[model samples]
Structure formats: structure tokens, C-alpha cells
Target: MSDTLTIALAQINPVVGDVAGNIRLIRDARARAAAAGADLVVFGELCVCGYPPEDLVLKGAFLESCEAAVHDLAEETAEGPAMLVGAPWRVAGKLHNAALLLDHGRVAATRLKHNLPNYGVFDEARVFVAGPAPGPVAFRGIRLGVMVCEDMWYPDVAETLGESGAEILVVLNGSPFEMDKPNLRLEHARARIAETGLPLVYVNQVGGQDELVFDGSSFVLDGQGRPAAGVAPWTDAVEITRWSREPDGWCCEGALAAPVSRLENVYRALVTGLRDYVVKNGFPGVVLGLSGGIDSALCAAIAVDALGPDKVWCVMMPSPYTSADSLEDAALVAGMLGTRLDTISIEPAMAVFGSMLAPVFAGREADITEENLQSRARGLTLMGISNKFGPMVLSTGNKSEMSCGYATLYGDMCGGYAVLKDVYKTTVFALSSWRNHTRPPGCLGPGGAVMPERVIAKPPSAELKPNQTDQDSLPPYDVLDAILDCLIEGEMSVPETCAHGFDEDMVRRVWRMLDRAEYKRRQAPPGVKVSSRAFGRERRYPITNAFTRLI
Candidate 1:
């Protein structure tokens, strides 16, 4: 009998629905762990078909492919260490989120996930059928209990495992990032360990799959409810941790690096998410218009940092009303970042479009409509370049503009991805300053002055019309972002927002704009989500609603 076990946590990035590729990853990870003398190697949830396969699980062919992949993985374990991996299993006409125990080139045992999370970016109920609470599976000599993603969020799952004579509990997960979520996971694991008195190992996937960024801070919690070992966020690493059975319980011998700061972690998540999306989706590079405003500058910086200077292209689509300072600062940023810079003056395109639409707008006084034309012309030019070349167009609009419908639809909103869609305007400024001063971990771009000083200090504007600024239409970004956090993220009622030192009228106005902008947001492209309440799946607001207050 063994009194100690060394387990490997495979913090890997899986491409969605790539069964063959995913199986290869699992095999490679198991081999690495075996070479390190680990007893078993565990991977994130849904390793076979990838996480949140969405509706792809409904297809019979896909399930068959998943089964075939599992068989291949089982076969690959012939020479390596044991494997505990997650996959979708269909039994008796019901689908289950299952964790399989593979040993000696065969399917040793199977455990089904009990919890099916259906809320907030998760639609497990639509794809998966929950299984009864699984008992412990004996691997080698140790009994291990397995839980899928949502199972760790609760206490009973771990307690049931502890009661069933399980020595270690391993959780496979694909949890996404949303501002301090790693800390929340740590707290939850601590609570679970306190309840069960069992060592817990959590392995999570890392990468961006359609607006969701999973920060792979896979960790192990000892019986004392403290973190024993882990990997960093926004990275892929395989770590083998040794745990010994002591008089008290399983004790960890060594842990990994310290946890990253919230800011740094979130920033890495955004960069990782964007980089993976652009590369994995087969885009050669990215192109975006730089307005010298914080949003565009920050997006450009993130693009360059994500994909190197070779992969990022910056175009200055200056219009008639574009300020000299804006033009100079935009050029400065492009030059500093070493991006392939080009100037596509939208004046010519704007004139052509204006003439084409002149008969239609014959009598209507030139309002925001004409200004939006210029924005759309710029959008078309960027898109044309994206089509002529192969780079995906990255939208530079932030959450604040998206929230208040301040962005022109089919104008600045045209893009394959929006990097700053989840970030607030105030936060955009903060990130810009942060990027200018500090280089992100693993960032390939140059460290200093990625964004120009003047770009960070300038007042935000669209430059669509003469003397037009964001403040002309909406509240100052600081005030507006606060109110939006209250209305959209905090879910505060207008009265509650007013209680927080905001004027009632202003609060009502901001709330009204947020309500009216649902249509625009619905049509907006998917972007990396860095906040708790992103406009996409996290918060669902009706496009047409008469009710104003939640109460």
C-alpha cells in the first residue's frame, strides 16, 4: 500500500470539437506525467470534445466521435500512468457529463457529474443530462472522487465524496474569468476542503472560445482548506504535486508560484483570449482604426501585444473634422508600437457616400445621421482592407459606448472581434496607462510607450462631426461608468443609484440609454469579457421593454 501519491494537473488549452487533437493532448500529457513518476494525470472538464460544445453535442456523429476519441485515449494509456479525464457519455438514452477512469489500456470506471449549471454563459441543461452523485473510483491503490465544473461550487458534492471513503477529490473544470473569479474559486475550494477534510485538485482549461476566457489557475487544496499547489492564469502548464497521507490527512510537500494580481491576471486573460481567437480562427492578423482616443489606442496596444507587431495593422481613417492632435498622437502610437501603419483618408469615401445618400436626405437638417455616415464609411474602408488582405477587423468600441448606444451601428461596430467590449471607458483609460508603463507577462511587444502620452490624456471622441465628443451625448465616462456599473452590473435600481450620490435625473437618463441600447448590443460582435456582468450571455436585457424598474 502506498502512503503517498504524486498527481499531475494538466492545465491545457483544448480547441472546441477537435476530438482527435484533444486526445493527442491527453496522451501527451499522460506520458509527461508518467515520465515524472506521477500516479495519475487529470485534465480539465470536457477534454474529449472541449468545453461548452454548445449544440454540437446534439449530433449523433459528434457523440460517436467523442466515444471514438475516448477509446483512443484509453488505448494510449497502455504504457503511461492512469488517467482521469472528462467527456460526454451517453448511457441509456441520456447524456451525462462524465469523468472516466482509464487504467492499463481499458476503461477502468466512470463517474457522472451531478450538477448541471445552466445560467450565465453555461447552457449545460441544453446539452447535458445530469448523472447521480458518483461514488469513488479506485485507481492504483487510492480512491479518487471526480466532480465536473459546477460540482465544486457546492459543498455536498465534496462531502459525499469524503463520506464515501475517498482519499482525494479531483475536479475537472472549464471555469471562465470575470474579475477576481480565481479568488472566488479559491474561497470556494477552501470551504469545500473545510467541509470534507479531503485534499482537492482542480484543473481548468485555458484559452478563449467565443468571448469567454478561462484563466487556468488549476490548484490543489489540502485537508486544512489551504492552497497547496497551482499553475498561473492565462497559461498552459503541467504540474506534478506530491501529497502524502499523514496522521491528519493528505499533506502537500511543495506548491507552485504565487497568485498573480487581479489587474495583471485580467489583462493576461484578455490578451490570451484575443490572441487565441485570432490565431485559432485562422486569421492572418488584425486591423483596426486608431482614433487616438483611449479605446482605440488600448485596443491597438492589446492587438500588438497579443499578436506581434507583424500581425497587427493600424490604419488612420482621418476625416474632415479630425483634429491635428488626434492625427499626430495616432501616428506616434503606430510608430512607437512598430505596427504596419497606413493612412486611408475617409474624406474621399465620405464624399462618395454622402453624394449617394444626398437625394435620400434632401430636406432633413444634417443631424447625427450625416455624422454616422462618416463613421460607417470608415468602417467600410477598414472592412475592405480586411477583405483585400486577410486580417480580421478588430472593433475598438468599449462597453461605455456600447452601453449608451453612443457607437454607430454598421459604423464603428463592424468587426470580427471587439477587444474592449467588456471594459468600461474609465477602465480603458486605466488599462492604457497600465500598458504604457508596464509590460504584460509574456507580452511580445515592446515594453515602453506602447500608447502615446497624448493619446491617454485626450478627451474621448468619435470625430464623426465638428466639435463632437462623447461628453456631448453622454455623461463623463467616470460618472457614466459608475452609473452603468450600478444599472447594468450592480443591478441597482435607479433609486438605489441616486442613493449612491448620483442625481436622480442623471441616473434615469443613463438607465434609459442602457435600456435603449439593447438592440445595438445584441447586434454587436463578441469580445473578451473581463467583467462580472458582460453585455452578452451574462446579462440578458430585452430589446423592447416598457418596465423601467426591477422592483
Candidate 2:
């Protein structure tokens, strides 16, 4: 029987459906683990073909490729440390999310995921069938309880493994990042440790996958539910932990990363999501309209931080209603970030459109149609630059603007990706202030304030018309965000929302707006999913419906 063991937790970023690239990542991690003298290397769920492969796992050829890659990886384990990796496997004519143990140039054992998640950002039940409750896999004289991502969430699996004589619990996860998710993960892990009286190890994937961003806050918990070791969030890491069999149970020893602040984590999520989406999709750089407003300014800062200032191109498209303060702020922001700034006036386009449409409306007064034309002109200007320079246009609409349909359809919403799509306006102000005071690790932007303080302090405006503030069309951001949280995140009814000290009439109005804007949200670009109930796959609502009235 072995008295000592070394397990290397490999936190890696894998692209979905890229079998060869994923294999290379796995092999590189294995080589590093072997050099560190590890007995086993543990990787996240679906490391072979990436996590949440969506419907890609349904393809027979993709599954065959992943299976072949696993075999090839197993052959490499003959002379080095064994590996425990996750991949989709076809067993008995049914596909399962299986964790395979590779040793001695062969596949030793496999454990299928028992609980398939079907809520929030996950739909694993649609693609993978649930396996029977797993016991433990024997490795180097230690019976290790192996549970896939969702399996650790329930008690039945852990209890079964503990009763079956499992020594340690290892969980392979691809859990996406939401606010307060790290603490929630720890709570669940501690619960399992309490039930089993066995130490647990968690390994999670890190990277941007479509709207989802996986924060790899992998950690280890002792038998007494105390933190033994951990890796930081928002980055890929390979941490080696030492374990020795003590009299009571197995103990772990390693360094613990400092806890990250909520604001810092949210900012990092935005940067990481934007970086991977632009880089993984093979875009040279990003071009965004840098309005003087808080939303566009924050989007510019995030883009500059994600891709270096050199790769970020900012343009200021001023209209007749554009304030001089906005022009000055935009220029100062560009200078501070060291990004190229260009000026393009949309006055000519507005004039041309007005003249072209004069025949249809001989005596019609100016209204929202004219305001929308200004936004569309600016959108066209940005898209034209994008086409000429091969850069993706970034939209700068936040959740608050998107929620009440306060944004123009093709105007501000014209972008390949929306960096602040899921972020509320109030949170945008908070993040801007936080970034100014502190610069997080792995950022390419300047250390000091990226924008003038007045930018955040000023009232937000679209600048479509004169002396117009966001409040002219919508409620105050603080109130609007709170009401939105209740309706969207809490899924509270009108009366329930009003119970939170909100006026009944206002709550009903907000609810109506929220329901009416579903179609606009349907056409919006995908952004990072940081909230619990993001608007995409996580929260789906039918556009044409009478459910709102009934509620």
C-alpha cells in the first residue's frame, strides 16, 4: 500500500470541437505534471473535446475522433504518471460523460457521470445519459471516488462512494462563472467532505465558451472541511498537491491563493470572455464606438485590457447633439489607453437620409425615427471601418438599456460581440470605478485610471438628442437595476416584486417592458454570462405570448 501521493490539478482552457488542439493541451499538461513528479494528473470535464460541446457530441465522427485521441493519450502514459481525464464516450450504444483512467499505456477504468445538469447554463441531460451510482476507482493502492461535474452536487453519489470505501473524492468540473459561484462551490465541496469524512479535490476548466466563461477556481478540502489548497480564478494553472495517509484519514498540503474581490472577479470575467472570443475566433483586433457615455467608455477599457491598446481601435462618431464634454472625455480616454482614435461625423449620412425620406413624409415632425437614423448612421460608420480593417465591432449596450429596449436596434446594437450585454448599468459604474483605482493581474492596459473620474460621475446619455439623459426615458439606474433583479433573476411576479418596497404601478410597468423587449434581445449579440439568469440559453422566454398579462 502507498503511503504518499502527488496529484497535479491541471486547469486548462480548451476550445470546443478542436480535438487536435485539445489533445496537445492535455499532452503538454501531462508532460509538465510528470516533470513535477506527480503520481496522477487530473483534468477538467470534457478536456478532450472541451466542455458543453452542445450538440457536437451527437456527431458519430466527432465522438470517434475523441475516442481515438484518448487512446493515443493513454499510450503516452505508459512511461509517465497516469492521467484522469473527462471525455464523451459511447458505451453500449449510449453516449455518456465518462472519466477515464489512463495507465500502463491502456484504459484502466471508466466512471460515468450520474447526475446530468438540466438547469441554468447547463443542458447535459439532453446530450448525455445518466450512469448508475459509481463506487471508487483503485489507483496506486488508493480507492479514489471519481465524480463528474454535476455528480458532486447531490449527496447520493458521495454517500454511496463513502459507504463503498472510497478514500478520496475527485470531481471533474466545467462549471461556468456566476457572481458568488466560488463560495457556492466550496460550500458544496465541504458538504460532501462532511458527509464522507474524506478529502476532496476539484478541477475546473477556464476559458470563454460562447456566452459562458468558466472560472477555474479549483481547490482542495481536507476531511474536516477546511481548505487545503487552491488555484486563483480567471486563469489557467497547474498546481501540485502532496498527500500523505495519516492515522485519521488522508491529508493534503499546498498553497492557497488569496481570495479575489467581487468587482475584480467580474472585471476579469469580462476581460477573459472578450479575449478568448476575439482570439479563439481569429479576429485581428476590435473596433468600438467610443462615446463619452459610461457604457461605451467601459467597453473601450475592457477591450483595451483584453487585447492590448495597439489591437484596440476606438472611433468617435459625433453628431449635432454630441456634447463637447463627451468629445473631450473620449479623446482623453483614448490617450490614456494609448489606442488609436479616429473622428467620423455622421451629419452627412443623417442629412442624406432625411433628404431621401422627405418625399414619404412631407410635413411629418421630427421624432424617434430621426433619432434612430443618427444611431444607424453611426453603426454604419463603425461597420464600414470594421469591414475595411478586418476587425470585429464591439457593441456597448448594457443589460439595463437592453432590458427596457432603451437602445436602438441596429444603432448601438451592431457588433460582433457585446462586452456589457449581461452587465447592469449600476454594475457598469461600479466596475469603472473599481478599474480606475486598481488594475488586476494579466491586464495589458495602463495601471492608473483609464478614464476621467467625471465620466463615471456624469449622468449617462445616448446623446441622440439635446440635453437628453437616460433618466428622460427610463427610471433611475439604482431603482431600475433593483426591479430588474427581482423580475429577471428572482423570477418574481408583479406583486412579489412590489413586496420589496417597490411601488406596485412601477413594478407592473417594468414587468411589461421586460416582457415587451424579448424580440429585441433575441436579435442581440452574445455577451459574457456573469449573472445567474443571463438572457440567452439560461433564461428563455417566448417573444409572442400573453403570459405577462396572466402573471
Candidate 3:
């Protein structure tokens, strides 16, 4: 076996369903690797049609398009180095998540994924059939084993490949971020290397698609399960590593850099997710409703930082109940950020709706139905602007409102993307404070106090009715977010949430609302998921369930 082989991994972003565009990306990346004198280039999982094509894979024409794109990619390999790229291949009338080995202007071999993850945000079992035995392909005078995304999660894939005369293992991944998931990936990879006694390279996709964000923390581990080379998170890079075969198998010879902070990594993931959602979808810019509330304020900061002031338009839709402080605070914050600000009073539309629904009210006492109408009217005005202009409307509701049915269905929830839908209310406040103290890398605003002090200090409210606060219907946000953390993220039973010094009644109340709100969450726009158990795709609850939490 030869000792000196150079491998290149291209951690690049690919938009879903953009076959021609993705092929161009692959061609460009492979050209760069060939220019650097590398033997072969590897890309992340599902590079042809992009990661988690979701239901797009179900379409026969789309899969055919992906296949056509892969063939075009295989021909390009003749001009450069061999390419190990991930895509979908149908064999025996079943679709498999596969990686193709391209050399000498053709596909030399295909490696299919074995483990299909069905938990959390993954539903691979529903889409792809599990692969069979592992095999090694001869590329550049070396036998290399290729494993797709979830295949790397299991030890059997690496062990079988290593035992079958494979010299190196390369795994392509479209793994989504979930808090400390990168650390978990490293730990799992080390264990697999220790068991297989083979050097391994892991490459992952970067950027946000819908509710999922892929953190590109691609790294190489030596035969002894030691770190070799790595690329940073939430950014695109092409990393080339030189390896040598030893008595023990293969080892890496290079100086490894320090790892970035967890805070920094997560913050970058949010930014990347935001940037991709806006750019890839072909929106001219983004428009957000700027309530002085923490959720809207945080989303405005993220939008301005992601797309800059010229692209972000902030509107203050004040109602009769709108506080002078909230209106002033919102305008003040928008001024600091330098984004285009517009105020559209909803009172006129409110009168129209009020008059229209007067017969139905029938002299009854006004309730939350009237309050929700106010929210829905505001939503319609924003949509009207979005229809006339090309800017995408960005909704500001957080995970807490999304989880407990606190948000109106077509009201505050209407938008192209829910910027903070995956972020908890508590986290919204924390990130807001963090942004005020120290801005992120590309924040487009004044130095001090992007959000007003009064905004953060005041008690939260919908302000639909006179003197109505959020606590009237729910607990304190501090208490409410914590209980939700336990119930939703922690997956705690009703009793388990109460164990955390919470009142049992409050815990039960939060849990009940969370259970009943499943339908609303299903209809929400995609948001950047920052936690393990964001309300959509991950934690599923039946909308029709009748079980009640006992007090």
C-alpha cells in the first residue's frame, strides 16, 4: 500500500432542486482541487440535488433530473481528479442514498448508505431503502471506502470496509445542527476509528435549508483516532490533507488548530441559515415587523446583520392599543440600524373588520377573537406590501409562541420565513442582550443600544386589549420558557417538568397547550433551528389527542 496520498474535501453549499446550478458548483470545486495537485475531490452527501431533498425525491422526474446531473458530473472527472460525490441511485426499482466514484470520465463504483436515521428531523427510511454490504473502490492506485451520511453513524460500515482491504475511509454527511451536535460527531467518529483501526475523513454540508441547518465542521481523523485536519463551522472551504501509511495503517502529519467557541459556532450557523434562505430563494430583500418586543427586535437585528440595511425594510404597524413607548422604541431601533422604516397604522383596517364582524358579535362581550383580528389585519397589510414589492416578509414569532398556540395562524405568523421560529423566547432575550453588548461580525447598525432598554425591561404583552399582558394567559416568560424547555426539549412527562420546582398546574397547562398546537406549527414557515427539539419535524404530537395532564 502506498503511504503518500492527498485527499481534498470541498465543503460547499448547494441549493435543493437546482440540478444545473449544483453541477456547476461541483465542476468549479473539482477544478480547484485538481489545480492544487490533489488526487481526488470529495463533496458532502446528496451534492447532486442538495441535502434533504425531502419530498422532492418522491417525484420521478426530479430523481431522473438528478441522475442526469450526476452523469454530466462523471464526465467532468476526466479533466480533473477522481470525484467521490453523493447522490441518489435507483437499483432494483428502489431508491438508495448513494455516493458515486467517478474516474476516467465514468462512474467506477457506487457506495450506498446503510443506516437510515428516522429520529429527530430525519425521515430517510420513508424515502430511501437501506444499502447492503460495504465495498472498496480502486481510485488513484488506492482502495478507498466511501460511506454516506448516516452510514458513518454506525461502526459496522467502517469495520466491514477496513476488514475488506480498504486503506482509507471517506464519509460524506448532510448532518443538521442540534446544539452540541458537532462535539457529538467528533466523539462518535473517534470511537469508529478506534474500532476500525483506519484513518477516516468526514465531510459535511453547510448552510440552512428550511428548518434544518448544516454545520460544516469537516475533519480528518488518523488511524489512531487522533485529529489531523479540520475546517471551521458555518463557512465554506476546500481542505486538502496529506496522509502516510504506517505500520499501524495510515496516519496524518500536520498541525491541528484550536477549535472555535460553541457560542461562535452556533451564532455562525444562525447567520448562514439566514443568509442562504434570503439569497437562494431569490428575494429582493427582507421586510420585518419591528415590535419593541424581544422576538421582533432580535429578528430585525439578525435580518440587518444578514442582508444589511439596504435590503431590510422594517415596518411599525401600530394599532389603537399600541403603546407610545413601543412605537417610539421600534422607530428608535430602526433608526439605529439604518434600515428603511415605514409605519402602517392598522386602525383603519381594524374598523373595517370590526364593522364587518359586528353582526356576528351580536352585542356580545369582546374577547381574544377581537384581539386575534388585530394581529391578522396587521399580517394582511404586510402581505399586501410584500405582494406589490419583491422583498420577502420575515415573521418574528419565536418557538415559544409557535409551540403553545400563542401566535395567530394567519396573523403574526404570515411570512416567507420565520427567522426566529426555532429560537426559544428565553433565548431571544439572551441573544438580544448579547447583540446589544457585542454585535456579531457583520451587524449593520450603530455601536451602542440597537434595542431600547425599555423594550427589554418591560413585561411582554400582545397589547390587543386594554392593559392585556402575556401573563394573563400564560406564566412569566422566564418560568414559561423553562417549563417548555423541560416539556418540549427535555421530552419530560408532565410530572417530570413539575420536578424542576415548577407549579404542577402551570406545567400541565403548558404541556396541554403544546399538545393541542401541533396543527399551527405544521403550517408555520421554516425557521432556523438552534435547539435539538424545535417544534417542527423533531417533536411531533397528535393534534387530535384528548389526553389531559392531571394537576
Model 1 CA deviation exceeding 4 Å by range = 549-551
Candidate that would win on TM-score? 2
**Model 1 agreement with the true structure over 58-80: per-residue lDDT tens digits:** 89999999998888778877876
User: lDDT ranking from best to worst?
Assistant: 2, 1, 3
lDDT (10s digit) by residue, model 2, range 353-426: 99999999788999999999999999999999999999999999999988999888898889999989999999
lDDT of each: 0.86, 0.93, 0.83
lDDT of 3 by residue, 122-180 (tens): 98999999999688888766888888877778888888887898888899999998788
| Order of quality (TM-score) | 2, 1, 3
TM-score of 3: 0.94
**Top lDDT hit:** 2
Q: Count clashing residue pairs per candidate.
A: 0, 0, 0
